[model samples]
Target chain A: MAIIDLNNVSKSYVSGFLMRKKKAVSNISFKVGNGEILGIIGANGAGKSTIIKMIQGFIRPDKGDILIDNNKPFDPASRIKMGYLPENPYFYTNLTAVELLRFSTSASGMPKQLADKRIKTLLETVDLYPHRKQRLKTYSKGMTQRAGICFALVHDPQVVVLDEPMSGLDPLGRKMVLDLILDLKAQGKTILFCSHILNDVERVCDRVAVMDKGHLRKVFTREDLGNQTMEEVFLHTIEERSEC
Target chain B: MLNKVLSLSILTFLEGVRDRAIFGIGLFALAMMSVTLVVLGFFMRELDKVAVDINLSAISLAGLLVTFFLSINLMAKDIDKRTIYCVMSKPFSRAQYVWGKYIGILFIISTAFAVLTFCSSLTIVIAKMQYTNWFKAFSWIEYFKAVYASFLMFVVLNAFIIFFSSITSSSFLTLLFSICTYIAGQTIEEVVIYLKSANGQEAQLSEFIQKMIDILQYILPNLSVFDLKVQASHAIHLPLDYLLAITGYAAIYSGILMIAASLMFSRRELP
Candidate 1:
């Protein structure tokens, strides 16, 4: 069964009365099988994050439904099987990185004995363990993003959804996050990531889906993105959106 | 599901405590109740009832003011700063988030009320020698009616502020609307009073006022029910029905407002 599936899904936002509702994702349909690293590329406001939101159950689609492991993705049971790292994720600044990780995993239903052990593992997984005791407010952007990813995966979910997970990282931090994604993929975890940074997507994503103005413009593989750099492919898809 | 609600709500409580902004407002409110000593001597003739009324008025004002201000700012800032997306991405539902925030704000407001009420009572007692013996000299019912009801009213006031904040996107608007509701809601009894004047009956003004009163009483909470000071001051027994009615209304009204807020937040697209 597909790990994540969107069938004729649509979402729109009403600005106010008498104004037309802007459709963010319209009749978007796609399926991601288990263990697939699917990278979604889009310009700003291109509905990439909207797909992740629907899958995360953060926002309900106006039409259609999403399935995770052949079950409704938004159900709490499905959420238990998935992990998500939001773009520019924010956390409780008062908590130390370790404390926050412990809290997140506990909230995800990890047993206390197991949660403590996993916290140690995740700290090393994201390379934030060196500064794990420090409060979040003191961390750099890349550090925070790494911690955010740690929180998402603390439960060892089957599918991980990451939106711009490595956007603000330094070269070293970016490389660490990429290596982590590859590691998670190797562990048989499916990943759906959205980013404008095509190089990282090209390096890690086994498959690629380009979205534009709420439409699924194209879906291809590494070879397709390789036919031209992801930047060239992304620019071409964006231009196609503008033309339509 | 209840655990989800409770866990998320606890975060709201902790977040409210960590906000640091509420501390300043809370201290200021405490000082306001302390300063009511001067306010008491000025109204000393009626002493107890007037003191209870004005002091509760101060507490209701502060609790409503802060709850309305804080809830909106907290929710909006979290979203603006993108902290909420991370939290929401967990197994937490949006409604759970809203309810959790409301619960946290309520905890803060409730604690603030306890502190302010103690200060207000102390202020009232220290103002005059006659006031110190005031409670014991009378039926214990007076203080229970006056002071206990005052605290209860503060709870209702928090409910009002929180409910308003849940629906209104802007904190300022929520604060303004809540204040208007508090002030205008209090004045409704007087409007109803004028309706029964029988003197205003000749002018046909009584019917209009009555109609206005009915509409407002239905739409806005009857804050007067929570004001037991008048009965206390007169040493009249407070009807248990009044307090029960106020609490019942608070539960129903706050629930409606929260439901409305959850509906709004569920549709909100986090930026």
Candidate 2:
């Protein structure tokens, strides 16, 4: 069964005094079934983040319906079992990583004793145990990213959504995140992620969805990829869509 | 839901208390309190009035500074820095965000007020000890009444700040609107009274202008009503009924403003 579904979702942003409407995503629809890793590959303006925001209910779709656990995206109940990490995740600079996680646990309604155990384990998993007491303002980019991942999983959410989780990381940092994603997948978690790094997507995704100019061009599965490089597949897909 | 809001509120308060601006404001209030000693030394005849006026003005000035500088930043920084994205993605609604943030700000404002009031009252005591004869008519109860009224005024001001924070896209705009609201709220009653007196005279003011003033008076908060420092300084009789009435006025006005803010914020799209 699908844990997350977006049926014909459409969203547009109006900008400037003239209110010139720009279509961010148009009638895009897809779903991530239970225990599946779906990687969305898109360019900067291809509406990947827009879709994530709608699914997270930070904004509403101009048309269509979004269901997380068959509940509307805006419903707090819909987000109860979900975790999200935004691209370049920013947090309260004044708060330490441990404090931030404590806040997250409370917001997710986790019991205190359980949250304490989970928080320690998650912090250790991200190799941030030593820096847990430092303010987020004092953290390096890699440290902050690791702390962000821990925050997302602090409550042991069943479905995790990560937007550009690999951004601004060195090879070692990227590898750490890649390994974390694999670990979550191994634990039978449903993961939906968007990344510009096609190689990482190819390496980790069960099925890869290519988006271009607010449209979902294709969703390529592992069997379909065979030995073809994701770069070639992604380029060919974009070319084919442009020609059509 | 309450737990989530409380967590956010506590987080916001923690962040606010750690801000350098808040520290600076606190130091400034402290410095102002110290200056009251010197200012009172210069006034021999009206020592009691000088002490109350200087101390109360210090607290009010400190509050205004915090409202414009610190409180506005607390609300706008989350949105500006995109930190709001992570918080909003939680199992909480945008209305909860607004209320949580508002509650946090209230905590900060109240904390600051309490500290400053304590310092001011201490200075007043020192001055009273120095000039025992001058404070023969002074009353501590009346002084606390003024402080309580000032607290209510700030509650109303912070509500206005939250309302503007929800509607405006930029911090500068929020500050601008809040300043305008403060000025209008502080003086609109006097403006209406002026217009009424002019109306009694022959054709001094136009009906349209009078009508506009009347409308403004009805909408804008009468912040002047919260100013009991003069009466407090003089130890005048302030009826309990009047205080209760103004307190009710503040509650109803701030309640409406908060509801409006929550409604506007719930519809706001995060960038």
Candidate 3:
């Protein structure tokens, strides 16, 4: 069954003094079935982040529908079992990692004993246990990204949405995140992963969706790639669409 | 729902208290209170009255600074810095977020007021001890009433801040609107009084102008109601009914503002 669904979703935004409307996403739709890792890849302004934002209910769609576990995106109850990490994740800088995670757990209604245990484990998993007491303002970009990961997963949410999760990570950090994504998939969690790096997306995602100029150009499973690498397939697909 | 709001509120409070600006404001208020002692010596005749006025003014000034400087930043920073994304990703409605943040700001204001009240009370006590004759008319009950009213005024002012923040994304704009509202709210009562008096009638204001003023009086808060400094300094006890009336006014005004803020905020597109 599909745990995350977007059916004929469309969104537009108005900007500047003239109030010109720019179509962000037009009638785009897809679904990530239970325990599926679906990667979304596109250039900037291709509506990749817009789709993620719509799914998270941060912004509304001008038309169509979105559901998380069959509940409307705008409803708070829909996000109860969801976790999200945004591009260049910005958290409250004055709070320490432990304090932030505790807030996440507490907001999700996690009990004290279980929350403490999960916080410790997640911090340790991300190799941030030693600096857990330091304020986020003092953390480096990579450290902040790791902390964001801990924050999203602290409540043991069943559906996870990640946008540009690998942007600030070092090679070792990237491997850790990749491992974490794979580990989450093993745990039967539905994941919507959006990233610019084709290689990372190809490695973890069961299927990859390619977006171009605010349209879902193609969505293909790993088996559909045949002998072609993701880089070759992606270039061919984008160039082919541009040529037409 | 309450639990989620409480969690967000606590987060906002912690963020507010840890700000370096808050510490600076606290120090400034304490220093002002300390200076009151030395300043009191100059007003030999009305020492108690001057002391009460200065102490209360210090509290009022501190609150204004926090509302404009610290509290506005706390509320606006979430939207300005895109931190709202992380917060809204959880099981929280936008309305819950607004209420939680407003309550958190209240916590910061309450803590600052509590500390300043303690320091101000101590200063008043020392002044009274040194010049018992001058403090003959001073009443502790009236002094506390003035402080309570001032705190209530801040509660209303913070609601205005939240309402402004919901409409605009810029913190600077929020501060500007709040300042204008504060100035207007403070003086609206006096303006209405003058307009209704014999002097105002001599001006022969047009019907349109008079109607506009009337509408504004009902719209903008009658902040003068919260000013009990003169009465407190003179030890003139206010009636219990009057106190209850203002309390009810603050409650209703703040409640309406929060509801409006939540509605505006919920409709906003988090770009």
Candidate 4:
């Protein structure tokens, strides 16, 4: 079953003093099935973040519908089982990792004892257990990214949406996140992963969707890639479209 | 629903309390109160009145600073910094987000008031002990009532701040609008009264100006009604009915502003 769906969605943003409407996404539609890992790869301004925001109900679509677990994106119930990590996740700097996780669990209605256990485990998984008591303001960018990972997973959500999850991470941190994604996949959680790292996308994703200039140019599974590298296929697809 | 709101409120409160600016405001208020004690020596008569006025003014001034600085930052900066993405992803509606943030700001204001009140009470006690004769007319009940009224003013003012924050895209604009609203709300009553006086009528203000002032009297909050400083300084008794009326007025005004803010915020697109 499709746990997340978007049908013919379109969005445009008005900018500058003239109030000119610039199209961000035009007539885009796709879905991630239950327990499936789908990766979205695109250059900057390709409407990748816009689609993620629409799915999370942060921004409404200019046209068409988006549903999570059969509920409209605007409904709070649609997000009850969702976890999201933004491109550069910024949290309240005054809060410690534990406090931030505690907030996430409480907001998600997790029982206190269970939440405590889960928070500790997630922090440890991200190698942030030693610094759990440190304020987020004091954390380095890489450390903050790791903390954000813990925050998104603390409630053990059914659907995880990560945008540029590996942006600020070091190689070690990237490996940890890759392992974590694989772990989440093993747990049968549906994942919508957006990243610029083609190698990582090729390694972890069941299917990779290539977006260019606000349009989904191609969605090819691992089998479709066959012996071709994700880098090759992505460049070929973009160049192929630009040639037309 | 309550759980989600409460969680957000607690998170906001924690974030607010830990801000370094709160400490600066607290220190400034304390310094003002301490200066009041030294200035009291210069007043030969009505020393009690001087002390009461200064203490109450210190609390009110500190509250205004908090609303202008910390409260605006708490709500408006979420969107400015994009920290709101982490928050809006939770299973809470935009209305819940507004109410939760409002409640959290109230908690911050209440905590600041509580600390300031305690310090002001200590200063008043010292003043009373040092000059017991002047304090003969000072009633604790009247003093506390003034503080309560001042707090209500902040409640209404914070609602306006939230309302402005919802409409304005930037924190600076929200601060500007809030300060303007407060200034208008504070002086609109006095302006109307002056225009109605016989001497004022002699100036022969235009009909358009008179009509505008009249409309403004109803539109802007009558914040002067919440000023009980003179009554407290003189130990004049306030009727129970008047207290109840202002309390009701604060509740209604804040309630309406919050509802409007929530509606406006819900329609806003988070980019």
Ranking by TM-score: 4, 3, 2, 1
User: What tens-digit string does per-residue lDDT give for candidate 2 at A160-190?
Assistant: 9999898778898899899999999999999
lDDT for residue A162 in candidate 4, whole number 0-100: 97
Number of colliding residue pairs in model 3? 0
Task: List ranges where model 3 is wrong by over 4 Å.
Answer: B200-218
State the lDDT of candidate 3 residue by residue for B143-249, as single tens digits: 99999999999999999999999999999999999898889889989878787667445557788988898877866797888999999999998999989988998
Query: What tens-digit string does per-residue lDDT give for candidate 3 at A100-218?
Result: 99999998999999999999999999999999999999999999999999988999999999999998999999999999999999999999999989999999999999998888999
Candidate 4's C-alpha runs over 4 A off are B200-218
Q: Which ten residues in a row have the lowest lDDT in candidate 4 chain B?
A: B196-205
lDDT of 4 at A69: 91
> Model 2, DockQ value?
0.81
Q: Select the stronger candidate by DockQ from 1 and 4.
A: 4
Clashes of 1: 0
Per-residue lDDT tens digits for candidate 1, residues A1-244, read: 5889999999998787888898999999999998999999888998998889888876788899789887675456777778889887788786688777765665677788998888888898778789988878899988888888888898888999999987788898888888999998889899998888888999999899989889999999887655588888888877877887
> Candidate 3, after superposition: displacement of residue A191 in Å?
0.6
Error of 3 at A183 (Å): 0.4
Q: Provide chain B TM-scores across all predictions.
A: 0.76, 0.93, 0.94, 0.94
For residue A235, what is the lDDT in candidate 3? 88
Each prediction's DockQ against the real complex: 0.44, 0.81, 0.88, 0.91
* Stretch of 10 with least lDDT, candidate 2 chain B: B195-204
DockQ category of candidate 2: high
Native-referenced DockQ of model 1: 0.44
Worst 10 residues of 1 chain B by lDDT: B132-141
